[model samples]
Target: MPENDRLRNIRKETLSSAWYTLYRYDFEYRRSDGRWESRQREVYDRGNGAAVLLYDASRRKVLLTRQFRMPTFVNHNPDGLLTEVCAGLLDGADPEAAIRKEILEETGYRVEQLEKILEAYSSPGAVTEILHYYLAAYHPGQKEAEGGGVPEETEDIELLEFGFEEILEKVRNGEIRDAKTLILIQYAALFGPLRPVAREIQ
Candidate 1:
């Protein structure tokens, strides 16, 4: 089917700047059969844009950043530490390129090749952010760059390299508390035909 014949019309688009930090919007549409639908989303409304989380398959490990999240601090935990994949807002660059750059900056591990595995909304009903997840294979080595996050961003980040089994344990224990991280870890665990249970100590 051609693009024009695929759908009927977009009924509405509501765009707004949120909390003076994020950009959020929604769209309402009508399909050919007169069905109405809507979706709410955000795209780096705070100028961060799109982001990628990478899994290094060759090393059987994942790269994550441990940083303080303000919201988490205010609402859930005081420390607000988040263990997440290398991610950043798009800043108008290509998503794949962004992932590669983020991997280098955050973990000091350069990724030569990246394979996109999934793209999903952070939270459609509330936040407009979409995440692009990827899997890249890399050999374990030293920091290829300065070794940590860009200081100006107040990102006192620590790089963590963990094998797949180790990471799944954290997830199962609720230690890897970030939503995106959880989703990506589960996706990688199920990458093959047989989805095995994550290894976690009881």
Candidate 2:
């Protein structure tokens, strides 16, 4: 959907084409007083994505991933390895299907049940990607393989299994920084699948 009338005269120019597309936008922003001003902005279009927090009720553990992120490395992360939920671009698949496939690839979890929680723009100010969020439950018998993502994609992912309560502390202490991952974990802890687990903290 396009922006409403508060914005006008949108002009977009292609600026880069590496892993994702970047564009420069020149537009007119209408003031509340009915005045208008010229504005310019840049947006990165990496396409939309889906992510899920996978949990095992019996073990009170959650599935997470650890991998190097170049962006964070350059941004002062001595170790670029990030703890995150299973996530990936939709790439033409429906949101539900994409998260399921991501779980299988990133963690080897073959999930049978999924609960979609919310959708949000993780970085709306500069990025144009909307993320679909979900929660999934898994068991030992459902692990189909030792998943480390596809080798061709340069994905050398490491699996991280943490007790639900422990991971929340990781989040509180700034150990988890990936936006979507943090959101999903907190979602599960506060209002979604893992609410009971979080409640036990009190």
The candidate scoring highest on lDDT is 2
User: What C-alpha lDDT does candidate 2 achieve relative to the native structure?
Assistant: 0.89
Q: Model 2 Cα displacement at 4 (Å)?
A: 3.8
lDDT of 1 by residue, 74-179 (tens): 9878788877877887767888888777777777778676778778887666555677877666666644786477788677789777876777778777888778
**Reference-based lDDT, residue 71, model 1:** 88
Best by the TM-score measure: 2
Q: Rate the local accuracy (lDDT) of all candidates.
A: 0.66, 0.89
My TM-score estimates for the predictions, one after another, are 0.71, 0.95
Give lDDT tens digits, candidate 2, residues 69-99: 9999999989988888889999988999988
All candidates: CA RMSD in angstroms? 5.3, 1.4
Residue range with the least summed lDDT across 10 consecutive positions in model 1: 192-201
Q: What is the lDDT of residue 81 in candidate 1?
A: 82
For model 2, the stretches where C-alpha displacement exceeds 4 angstroms are 1-3
lDDT at residue 176 of model 2 (Cα atoms): 91
List clashing residue pairs in candidate 2.
none
